[model samples]
Structure formats: C-alpha cells, structure tokens
Target chain A: GAGVSQSPSNKVTEKGKDVELRCDPISGHTALYWYRQSLGQGLEFLIYFQGNSAPDKSGLPSDRFSAERTGGSVSTLTIQRTQQEDSAVYLCASRAIQGASKAKNIQYFGAGTRLSVL
Target chain B: EDKVVQSPLSLVVHEGDTVTLNCSYEVTNFRSLLWYKQEKKAPTFLFMLTSSGIEKKSGRLSSILDKKELSSILNITATQTGDSAIYLCSQIQGAQKLVFGQGTRLTINP
Candidate 1:
C-alpha cells in the first residue's frame, strides 16, 4: 500500500525443496530490485527488473536462482533445489523513476523474507 | 564492476560518542550516493546525495558526499543506543541499480 511489501516473512524448507518468494512494490514505481544477505554479510545483488525486463541478472549466484516480475508490479524470486548455503534473507526494494526529482532513485525497502534451508 | 567499500566493518562505542562511517564507490557514471540504516530486517532510508560537498543532516545523523574522491561519509553526533544498527552505503549505478557496500555495523552501548 504505502510502501514496499514482501511475502513469507519466514520460511523453513528442507534441502532440495524449491521455494518462491514474492514482492509487491510501491504503486506506480517502475524499478524493483532483489538482494540476498547471508549471515553477517552485506547485501548481494541478485537481480533487478525495470518494467518487467531484467537487463542485469549478473549477480545471480548460480543457475538455481531465478526471478521474474509480472505486470511490472509484483515480482517473484525462486530457488531451485535449494541447498544449505542458500539460506539467507531476501530483500526487495522499489524506487520511482517517473519524475525528474533528485530523490527518484531512492529505494523503498521491504521487511524481507528470511529463508532457512534445513 | 561497480562496488562500494566501507571501513571499520564493526565498531563498538559508549553512548554519546561520535563516530564517522566511510564509504567509497568504484562505479562509472555514478549518479548518486545514499545512506540507509538497517534495523532488524528492513532498512530505512537516511539521505541521498548527488552534488559534492553538500552535507545532509537529520537530527544526530549527517552525511557528506565527495564526487572528486568518489567517497562519502556518514557522521553521527551524540550517539545513543537507538543509533546502533547496520549503516549501508549505496551508489546508484547503471540501469538504476544500487551498488551497496559490505555495510558498517555500529553498536552503541548505553
């Protein structure tokens, strides 16, 4: 509604089980980003979508990580055959680029989904 | 590759102590540098700096960006326990992506 929102605040899944996390960005905001933070580590950029197209997926750690955005609003990040090392907090952020304001690039972040692969 | 570097990855200080966090970017065509304070899971935005040498201040927190050095600094005066959190520095890179540093973890003891 007023800010970026994410789903499945906490998820505990067995190894090899696929998990899907969702993100709903601020309304009418065009740019969306997904990042992963391992324990005691900085955020690692996973992928970003600019109007349903991901121009840079270079940060995806491996083939097991995939993401997609539909309708340029809601985005989904999926992990295939998850492993223990895949456990981390997945954060989603959104920013508005429709205006010429200097703050247009400021990203509003979600509470994030904490995934634990057991 | 565009990346941000932060110094003093971890710091512990008593209340009322002043501290300065550093951030440097290695991004080409850098648009802006932003500072965020992350508490728990969500990170709250603090400041966005585009022009050099202009300091943005909010209460006990202040930040300055230097375009010539490709660096920025976040200064906190009269720190309190509530100010303890992960301070993140991000650079606006190509395609509107935010290139973030490893983050500086500051802990303030009461």
Candidate 2:
C-alpha cells in the first residue's frame, strides 16, 4: 500500500451508541499509532501498536475507549457508550520499523475518520 | 524528552505573504525533527531536518534546524490560499514515538 488507510471516513452516531473505527496500515509497517483531535485542539495520542502488542495502554482516555491490533496489520478502535465529547477526528498512522532506532521512523498517515456523536 | 513547543499559535495573512513558523524542543538527546502540513484530516509530510545549519526545502517550503538553540523554523514563501493549514512539528524521541508540538494554524486570505 502506498499509505495508511482508514474506513468510514465520516461516522455520525447517537449518544451512548457504540462505535468502531478501523485502520489498515501500509504493507510491512511494524508500528501503528492512533490519535484524537478535537476542534481547535492539537492531536492527542491515544494508543500505539508494535507488532500486535501494545506496550502501554495508559493513553486510553477511559475504560470505554479500547483498541486492538491483530496480525500486526489492521487495528480497530472501539468506543463503547460513546459520549458527545467523543466527537472528534480519529487519525491513524503507520511507520516501517526494522532496527531499534527505527521505532521513531517517519510515519505515513491516513485520511482520518471523523467520528461524530450527537 | 516530550517537550515540544511551537510559537504563533495562529496567524492570518494575505496571499503572496511570506511567513515563518517556529518550533523548539527541550529533548536531551535529539535525533531527528519533522515538519508536517495539515490541510484537512491527513497531515502531509514537509521536511525532516537532523543536521544543524542545513536547510531542507521543497518548492516554496523550506525548514532549518538549530541544535545549539534547540529550535527549528519553517519558511513558506509567497504563500497561497492553499497554504492555509495547521503546521505541525515533532521530535523523534528515541525509537518509541513522536513528541509533537502544539501546531501553528496559518490562514492565507485570498
């Protein structure tokens, strides 16, 4: 793949409705990241995956927010009982990592999914 | 080493104006720096500067890094309305992830 791909470019859900966002990383990309951006705000890190393993999950905003990556390729971010505050753009990015220092390598981003909870 | 700051949180200018965006990092061990332009949802890559005093350019967009001052600046010449976007800067913190700064919102009026 030439770049990262995200599904459901725009989603509008009722408050308390469950929402699932998907991300498909570039071929052979070992590192994947998820971020959230509210209106007029900077990107906030949510969670990241390294070969299907998330070393840190503290970035998750709350218990309702959870993410999983299977087969180290596609990832899904699930928001349960979504609130109005969850209405924001969810961005996904991926980077090809080989050696140790490559973990901070350049990341290719996908056209983010705008999640709107009303 | 997660501190990254960008100046001029927001700026508005007419077309053909030249603008400079600044970014400073306090990372003890700096490896690489990156600049990105966010138009809509996706942020397109602009430049990556690792060496001090060396300028990286693409079209009318150029950027330079200063290690001693722990800062970097992005210069866009003859800005167009299409150049209206949020410019982001990030520092590579080891091999874990990127430490990004609060982006500078640039708006170019036609």
Candidate 3:
C-alpha cells in the first residue's frame, strides 16, 4: 500500500462489548505504533512493535486494552469490555527502521478508526 | 513524566495573517521534535527538527527548535483559509515513542 491502512473507519459499539481495530502498514516498514485520541485530546501512545521484539505495552491504560502485531506487518488492537470512556479514535502508524536518516524516523499515519462506545 | 505543552489552545485569524504557535517539552532522551497538521482525520507530518537553531520550512509553514529553551515555534506566513486545522507538536523519545501536546486549533477566516 502507498500508506498505512486501517479497517472499519467508524465503529459504534455498546458498553462492555469488545472491539478490534486492524492496521496494515506500508510495505517493508519494520516499526509500528498504536495511539488513542479522545475528543479534544492529543494522541496517547498505546503500544509499539519493533520487528520481532516484545511490544512496548507501557502505555496501555488497562488490562482491557491489548494489541498484537502479526509477522511484523499487520497489527490488531483489541479493547475488551469497552466503556464509554473508551470512545476515541484509534490511529496506527508505521516507520522504516533503517539508517540514521531523518525520514526513517518519520511515521506515516493511517486514517484511523473512530470508536464510539455507547 | 514526559510533558509537551502547546500555547493558545485555539486561535482565529483573517486570511493572509501570519500566526505563530508555540510548544515546550520536557522529556528524557529527546531525539526529535515534530510538527503535524491535522484536519478531520489523522495528523499529517509537517516538519521534524533534530538540530537546534535550524529552521525547517515548507511553503508557507516554517518551524524552529531551541534545545536550550526546550521549546519550538511554528510560523505560518500569509495563511490561507485552507490552513485552518489543528497543529500538533510531539517529541520523539528514545527514537521509539512520541509524546504529544494538546494541539493548537487555528481558524483562518476569509
């Protein structure tokens, strides 16, 4: 793909329901990230996956929020027992991990999935 | 805790007017500062500053970083109505994660 792609641009789920968001990063990119953006709020880092290393889940708000990246290409973010506060936009981004070039550190973002838990 | 703060949460200006947005940060192992412009969806990357005192320019948008002050400024010259959007500032930490500011909403009226 030319850029990062996300599935289900919009999702409306009931409280306590589980929701999964998927992301397809650009070809050959080795680093991927997931973030959450609430209404009128900045992007909050959720998890980061680099190659086959263990993901950095330091930013996950709770145990309900879990994510997995398969084959270092596609990634999935699953929110279990969603609450009203979980209503936000979930964004995915990917970056090339190469030399020290500045562009390598730049992240390409997907359109994001807007999750609304009623 | 890593922190990024942006000033003037919101601003309104007439077309052709220039506007400057400010961002300050305090984070460990800061590797770069990035500026992004967001419309309805995800934010698009604008400029990434790694060196202090060097200005990065793109068309009407320009940004400069000052590591000594731990701050950066984005200047938009002769803004247009299409430039109306939210400007976000983020700090890259440990070359892995990004810590972002609350963002500045700029509205340019015709």
TM-score of 3: 0.96
Best prediction by DockQ:
3
Clashes of 3: 0
What TM-score would candidate 1 get against the native?
0.95
lDDT of 1 by residue, A1-118 (tens): 7999999999999999999999999999889999998998888888989989999898899999999999989999999999999999999999898787765878899999999999
Residue runs of model 3 more than 4 Å from their true location after superposition:
none
In candidate 3 chain B, what residue range of length 10 has the lowest lDDT sum?
B49-58
Report the lDDT tens digits of candidate 1 across residue range B49-85: 9864367998989999887798899999999999999
- TM-score for chain B considered on its own, for each of the candidates: 0.94, 0.94, 0.94
lDDT string for model 3 (A1-118, tens) is: 8999999999999999999999999999999999999999999998899975545888899999998888989998999999999999999999998866887879889999999999
1 against 2, candidate with superior lDDT: 1
TM-scores for all candidates: the values are 0.95, 0.91, 0.96
Model 2 stretches with alpha carbons more than 4 Å out: A99-104, B51-54
**Tens digits of per-residue lDDT for model 3 on B1-110?**
58999988999999999999999999666688999999988799999998643689989999999888989999999999999999999988754788899999999999
- Between prediction 2 and prediction 3, the one with superior lDDT is 3
> lDDT by residue for model 2 over A35-115, one digit each (tens)?
888887777778879989997665689999999999989999999999999999999999877755434467888999999
Q: What C-alpha lDDT do the candidate models reach, one value each?
A: 0.91, 0.87, 0.91
Candidate 2 structure quality by residue, lDDT tens digits, B56-96: 98899999888889899999999999999999998876445
Error of 3 at A106 (Å): 0.5
**Which residue pairs show collisions in model 3?**
none
